[model samples]
Target: MISSFSNNVYKMHQRTQIMRTTTFIKRRFSSAHITLKDSNYITREFEEISIPVPWGHLKGKWYGTRNVRPILGLHGWQDNAGSYDTLAPLLPNHLGFLSMDLPGHGHSSWLPLGISYHSIDYVSLLLRVMDYFQWDKISMICHSMSSINGFVFSALFPEKVDMMVGLDVLKPLARSSEKIVDNYKNCMNNIILHENRIISSEPPSYDWDELVDRLYYGSKKSVEREACKFLLKRAIRPSKDYPQKYYFARDSRLKTTYFYSFSKEVPIEMARYINCPYVFIKALQAPYYESRQHFDKTLDIMKQNPHFEYYEVEGTHHVHLNDPIKVAPIINSFIHKWRPS
Candidate 1:
């Protein structure tokens, strides 16, 4: 009887060990399957698309399906579509994003030989993009200069903008009448110089590390080193002469951007016209180029609108790129609330 009992106990122990091994194997396979599925899902999310213009085609990355209208993303001055690279992935996948390179930026065509880059010109670009996509109304996610553009656009065509999310900017810098006249003269001279450069000069090429360093410091170190790869996606191209070297693909003439800025009164008046859902996020560390009073005045006007919302986050001008996690949640929440089902 004792021998039979010992033998049964051994068999039970063996069965328990076998069950433990099987459970471990199942868990391992389940984890691997999840990782593979996520990788595949990411790969299938974004589609490359282009819109043809009079000069050339505007390149874009469409994140999500074409069946639904997308939230239009516009980058800051001199930045490209890749500006959204980090932030886009963090947002809800149910909504679509159409991040495009503005004229003279990224793979998009440059303006004609003598045509200068101006704030108003971007508004026209916005209109052209809408027309090309056959979108009766637009929803925008914009940063810096592009944010200002969205402000102008929404103010001018209140009914056309369904909703807008602006990051790190509220309005264009206001200047005295004297400064405006001076700026016009400076703008003309710079435009002429940039035009000549565009015709006669090729952008300087650099090694990969050097290119990343330049971009990092060029943004005053707002962009982190590791994050440089995101901007480099659309910003660099192989040099024609040196296979190993790369040049900035964006038009160098963009450096001489002209701003047909509005006075404080103008933006205030414009703010009155904006009645749609709007969100403005100010980076705490970013310089308020316009006076605090001016910023406050604009905010007050926007506050009167029932749908307007304002937020502040801790970061630099390129906060959306450097620390997307901090910005993405607020943006995603706003979009999720206002975006159409």
Candidate 2:
């Protein structure tokens, strides 16, 4: 009799679980757009468009409008358009901005099924975007890795980008010879694994709280708690099998070294050649890396470049995102002066 009662309880529990999962899925899919409001910023959902890339199609978000002044925005590695959640709203609304999720990040499609991601390829993608828009000139606001891309693009296509504001990491100069070999080896391994369909599966289901906590503690160490919540919208979704469970949409392989490794003479060379009106906001509190001399050498290039401007912002690497006051005015004034007369 007891055995039969226990079996009945187990079945009942399974049914309850199914009902919960169904409810969660309904809720998850129901709200696709979120309106964001803050002291000086108002944000609403933007449309997504797909553009063809060599490896595959890339998805991008259009913020503001085509009629507004044009500014192309780019986010950092592993970060999405959401990276600009705080700053985008602060920008002059009269200007239209296109903030894209580089391949392997955010809503942008990953490289064609078998291919791995490379930092250099993003520069080419930016060019394709310019061609798609038929934009003769673009103003740019880029953070971290994308900042490097912005500088490189500006250098290669000087007329294409009129002015730009780069937040931290203006250039990654002086990589050790050993590091270069290792990175190439790792990228090769990733390419092989990716082609072989050996990429890791999606992250396991987690609670919303746990997801936010991980992002805060891990990648977004400098982000404000309230601001961090905004990123959660893009990072999570209800699981089909569990009612209260949420899962990450990003590829699990994102954390692998195979996908991310520094190569020699990249952004450094890219930065030195930039000739457009550019401002570099260097973080004062954060150390460049294990080595400071190498970072100084890159800074020296910025020093020598006449068109390049540098500012020492008081915060960590991502400080501008959390405290816009430090970076917003710089962006605002630069745009005001550079906007076509």
Candidate 3:
């Protein structure tokens, strides 16, 4: 029997799933949409670094310039490096950015054949990304699900990051046993009932205009059409038969049932234990999954965390990447304050 709250949650979840799938199927590819300019100040370079996973090589790009200060940018789930393309321009000059597509998303190869994408695996991947760049310590800016990983990384390896900024999500700690069971049941229900299929038997070709519409109006709200095109290019690939088809390389099984309950005693304390300066930019309009009581308790842990500070932004989940004006300065200010003289 579905409780009223569970029923409401499932309805919202279904709507989101449908919209995402429709957007994924209809997304297009166009070179005219690539917005990164060949300017004097910004020098972009694409490079391939072996992630040393059992699967194979994972390609990443080093954006900005070689000599500039280094900052690592991690994108959200099912999103790629281009998530930063628009926001990167708004950042303060003189700092280099490294944006990498996580293993199962974007240009990077999958994790072998049978290996499923798990939340825990990202910790090791971040360390590998840091090691590949030869940066013993650096600053980080992350969005959505990636933000959770960033928080965990910061808590576990506080010394590695000089300062860290997380957008729209804090690292969620353990939940009550009932809540945990409910979440697990939902996941299992989804995996069993939902068939993970994006493209149709004959996928339709999409022009630039149609692609932008699906992205801007469909998933993201009030995003400029032109900016939407730029994101589409990174999100999609060219189809030979049709106009151009966009198919996400991210694993569909990521949506399947899974358990992520952690030890509340230690990890929440770990966030409190983070040694470096930390900033959390939360989305004001976002929904808190757990109840207000539990949510308040969790944030109380954050408030007590000495090295942490948080700011609320004016958007939905993907606040930072979607809106440059609100997020860019907050990131810049945090980094500027922490950067060495």
Candidate 4:
């Protein structure tokens, strides 16, 4: 009986040792997993940077490690680099993102006093940026008006763009020749008026809440008030005239900037030239500026390409900014598939 009792005690002690060892192993692994996650979080943080341009400089918020070539991010009209703030965090940490504020829009330098901003000018801007970065090929994430610019850039220089992910806009709006002619005179006149006015005038000042309200409404309520802070990052400055008031920092001329529209034929031709992997996310609630037929025609051409992917998300025009959760997963998947090994 004494021998049997001793054996039982020995077996129990061995079982206890095994349990303790298993627990220690699990705890060590858990600690290691947490450390790795924290490291990834730290690496994904953004850094502010400026790229020198012949006109002046372009400001950008770079996310991820500096050594890697980043996907160029372009915001919508009048929006800034902060437009990608929410979405950037949701993207994979292994890849980098460089969200730029187009000239006259954010902290970037405005164009020369007499010059007019044109949609085509942005194509040249893209080229200049690529040249500055010494990137032989680039990937892009463009929103709204900038998405159209990307379309044009990729179409013109197919070899330069490796891939593109567009938010809410596909191509330049198709306009009737008659409407173009009628609007041209007004567009030119407004440019002159805005130039003369901005040369001598300061932007109107507003209280912080008022500025937020304006931004919220200016987007037709598509951008939530909470999201206004992102846009305000590059759009506002402390008022010199009034204490605690802020002024819009973007160039006023942007309001009257020249917009170039193409017909169905132009975009269709451009689509054929786009051979890179392209992902276009269309917001269901966003207005289709061009006629349905024109929009459909352009998509038809793009769909013919095997690499083209399309998604229709339920959101507003500024959906990417207001609700990045809905857009980030789709973009993440696309990026993962095409990202360089």
> Which prediction has the highest TM-score against the true structure?
4
Off by over 4 Å in 1: 1-44
TM-score of 1: 0.85
lDDT of 1 by residue, 189-247 (tens): 78887677768766788987798799989988877775676677778777788777888
Q: List where candidate 2 sits over 4 angstroms from the true fold.
A: 1-46, 52-56, 190-201, 256-269
Whole-model lDDT, model 2:
0.62
- Candidate 3 lDDT, tens digit per residue, 1-341? 11232223111100011111101111221111122123122223434344555577676667656685468888877677767766666566677777777876767776654445568787778777667667788688888777888888888888888888887767754677787788767766665333434323323445555656666766556345434543454555555666444443355555552535664554567667676888887777776544555455656777775666777655666555444546666677777888743
- Each candidate's lDDT (Cα)? 0.77, 0.62, 0.61, 0.77
Lowest lDDT 10-residue stretch of candidate 4: 13-22
Model 4's alpha-carbon lDDT is 0.77
Per-candidate clash tally: 0, 0, 0, 0
For each candidate, give its TM-score against the true structure. 0.85, 0.78, 0.73, 0.86
Given candidate 4, what's the lDDT at residue 290?
81
> Per-residue lDDT for 1-341 in model 4, tens only?
22243233111110011111111101221111111111222123677799998889999988887777889899999999878766776678777899999999889999998888888998899888888888898899999999999888879998888889988889988888887776677778788888877777677899877987999899998777766776776788777888877888998888876787666588889988988899998988898888888888888899888888888876788877766656766787788999854
Candidate 3: C-alpha lDDT: 0.61
Error of 1 at 7 (Å): 62
